[model samples]
Target: MQVALFTILSSLTGGHVRILETAYRYPRRPTFLIPRNYYVKLLNMLDTYYEGRFRDFIENNTVELPPMEITHFYAYPKYIYDAMNRIKGDLSYFDLFYVPHEHIGMMMLLKGVGVKWTALLQLTPVIGALDVDLPMNPIRLMSLNLRLNGMGYIGDKLFEYLIAKAVLSGETVLSVSKSIPYEMRLMGLRARVKVLDPGIGIDEACFSCGDKDIDLVFFGRLRREKGVFDFIRVLNVLRRRMRMRPRALIMGASDDETPRLVKARLRELGLSGLVDVKVNLTRRELLSNLARARVFVYPTRLDSIGLVVIEALAHGIPVITYDIPAMRLNYRTRAVLRVPFRDINSMALVTAKLLSDEEYREGLANEGLRFVRRFDWVNVALREWEELGKIASEESKAPETKVANVIKAISIA
Candidate 1:
């Protein structure tokens, strides 16, 4: 049963990364994104607010499969069909249980299974925590950009609230950020929240593209928030201050508004000739570009924490980013110097100091390689799995006990 859950979550789930039928992530990276739409802003909003109020039903409501001994793969027609066909069994088989709000299908699937004692893992803030204040997601108004199309916009706060109700009620909630847990409480979920941020997956084994190292690399939507403008600013700074390790900025961008602006900024800065921008590169190629950079510039927002930072560190390059929770958590092993986010002068100063100092760059690299160690997919995978295991096992004890046990397990993990 445990194997089935792992296999299903590991494969066929949403996101840019997908595990193959063999249960090994297609490329072997330890991470995966939830299935998505271009409305990244809206998605971020829904992840937190669309609280699955029904989710915390793991204890007496259902049965569970132990961590090691379950098998059977079925990519049935859909969640509703699959639930009707497979999940109609007794609760005793599963001593513990879980439910990760992996997809709309899975969300609907739980209602039909007539099962209980399940914990569902979720990523993002918008979905379940609708009541929390969040900046408006611009993506909701995206269609307004296309001139000819009559199609208007998507995303509404009212709709977000409805989604949150389905997500927040989970018997146990698992998220990738510390903020998720905090948000859960602000919304009145007095207990039962866990944060198992899947740090950079074991990248070397998965993203190892013929070992050639380059000068610099950057990835993400080409937007100001990600600091591509800052990257350009620092490039100019390098021209003025840092001489050694002359850079060739290889930027990989996702299809988003940010990249278009980034390109425009690069042109405005007159570094168009200096920086090589690739808007859409295959995964292998993206890694290949990363392999080339000696150091990666990730001068993003102070609050933002994405898994990309860890992926870069895993590639043996130190990062120069604004000090934030994401980088702070990986402080010891990752090569990074947290600076004030968006301050061009500080960014430039740090860029000059670090890039010009070869000894420091090397130190940063060594430290980064070490820092990302704790996040190795294999190293942290079991701990995450066990967190779910304990939640499932202990939830059967009692509601207050269930919440207390799961929270304790998370602290230990």
Candidate 2:
């Protein structure tokens, strides 16, 4: 059976593309739908799919349409609609259209074009809360939801409406964590849902038990929601308690005002000389550095799952993160040092204790390495490929009108 993997993103920066890169390993040989001018150079640079049995169908010149950047929200649906309309062959030639992330616009357009589709749902912070990270005010949150589900409104930007459309159009809905699917059901999604945990590429031998040169390491996007400010506070507490400079490494995307704010905070805290801030490191570089790091600190507030935490575990590095639901879902064993959310002092104390106690840290590292060995990327790809086959066969004859009606009922709830 033929399938198409669609991504509206310009590059494979997050777990969304990591899933695609791993799924390409199976024998399905799905065709990838990428923007003609987007992610071309990045795909070549990544080189994970070079030897895979997959084909690329770049969306270009499908119709006489105006140019739009791949980063734009509306550009993807427009490009996909034109591509499906202008294809030389029959639409039935492709059995399924699989999107690794929630692209409501793309799903709606694909449904209109009579293509069966599946979507992978990972809870996004802003939309998952449906209140734009508002303060703890129940009245305000309920009022916002009321406006979102009100009548005479086009279902474009509302999370409930967009997700309802995607769920209605999708033949299957795969969630990375169990909590995400539960949350969707609460939001009125009645589609067939499955839990598929994300996998890592690291092996047991990936860890070297090396020099442990870096004292503390944090790897992810340097955004405010990632608890970058909180990380800085933890570092300050650690330094004051230890009475010395604590070496830390931060490697991730430094877009927007993050870099400026990080540097400013570092200067304000007098930590500019102790911290090493790097951006856009290759996977190999990240793993290499991780191997020599002592502790992995993930203070994120919005990640569905901390893949970097798993990577650190694979490298025999103990992790210190918040007791977020996503982390609890990801970690099955006593592998991580979980502290209360946003409690900088608790985090600092745990980090300091882990640093001081060598035997305890190594024990957690050993347990983590054993636990993560089961989640190899190949195993994950194989399971997803099997599920995809099942979805393709089982839902081949499913009626679109039935799913649409279900969504219509849910959207009004």
Candidate 3:
């Protein structure tokens, strides 16, 4: 079986492709299939996908892809949304050849080139799959029922309409969240789904990689939806509760109104004195910061999975995130506690519990360390390869590398 880790021209896709390539050791190195034109077209298309939701971001951000020939619509997300949208909605866009067709072409290319089966790494954001813009219960209701019986017939009518309309979104194989794979059956898609946890690559060897003896650290973008303002609130609560102020680091770049809103909120909350916000750092710099922190806090309302969470867990630091599926699905936190999504009080309460209970917090840190080790990119990568093998009817032919052996080898040698 041959595998391809895919990405659009955006940071979301680009980052994922890099993770799979660098972390997973395929029996033989797989080719990095990229075509800038496809991404260009995708950005151009997203410029119009969801009533300007994605399109707005495309126009606002400077989408700089690596100098590589990324595949055509294969990496384009809007193509998938549009095809599925037009078909499900049975919109007039059937006049245009679209997403599924795009997936078919890409898949055909792989097959035509003598590749048995190809793996597509699809990055599923919490906001997108679960619709984070709306209230949780409402969104959850939509997602929950969207996973039921008639939805397949409903989804299929859309899928068939899109395929018939010639809007072929190139998505032959789906690399999605664990739940979405099951949900797709309800939607009546025949394609196979491989649910792999998505986390940024974590290196365990460096002393600074997972070392946790510092005050506090927060890596990832500074955005409003990420609950940066709420973090400030939590900080304020901490100061009042502990009487000792904790120094915090905020690292990453932002493109939306979130940066401005978050900054304004910090000043409003009088948190400028406690927080040092930095934009953009090298991977090493980010890891170094993680190693120095006692805890990592991200109370986001929308994140399918935060790479920073795993990064923190790897360094043996506890994390505090809004309770959500992405976090629950991706990592088991010994040191992480979740509050309800967007609940500032609950966020502070749970976080304070960890910070106050030295023994409990330390125990969690140990659990987090063990948890992240299971989700090493090597394991995820190999698992994805196995999924492709199953699709190719070569599951038995694939070699099994014992997890225990691999773990000892990485930790020791």
Q: What is the lDDT of residue 227 in candidate 2?
A: 69
RMSD of 3: 13.8
Candidate 2 clashing pairs? none
With candidate 1 superimposed using the best TM-score fit, by how many Å does residue 315's alpha carbon deviate from the native? 2.7
Model 1 per-residue lDDT tens digits across residues 9-114:
3221122231221123212222221222222332332233223221232122222322221221112114233333444453344443334443322432333333
lDDT of 3 by residue, 1-413 (tens): 33333334344232443343442355644333334454565554334322233434334332233334434333333333222233344322122111111143333333322223444433331112332323344334445433431132233233322331222122335354554443333333345454555523455542344444555666666765555666787787777765657787777655566666666776886777887776645445556676878777887654555666767777778898865665665555556787666676777777667767778878988888777665555665666555555655633122122322322342343
TM-score of 1: 0.60
The global Cα lDDT (0 to 1) of model 1 is 0.47
Cα RMSD to the true fold for all candidates: 12.3, 6.1, 13.8
lDDT of 3: 0.50
Local accuracy of candidate 2 as per-residue lDDT tens digits, 1-413 = 78777664444455644665565566766666655544454445455422321223222212122333655343455566666656637567777778877656566555545567776765531234231223434334434533432312334345545445444544566766655654444454466777876534544346566788898888877876666777888999888776757689877765477878888889998998889887766656666777888888877766666667777888888888887666766686777878876788999988888888889888988999888777677777777777777777763544466444543443344
- lDDT top scorer: 2
Clash count list over all predictions: 67, 0, 29
Q: Rank the candidates by lDDT, best first.
A: 2, 3, 1
Off by over 4 Å in 2: 44-76, 88-90, 124-171, 186-188, 198-205, 241-244, 396-413
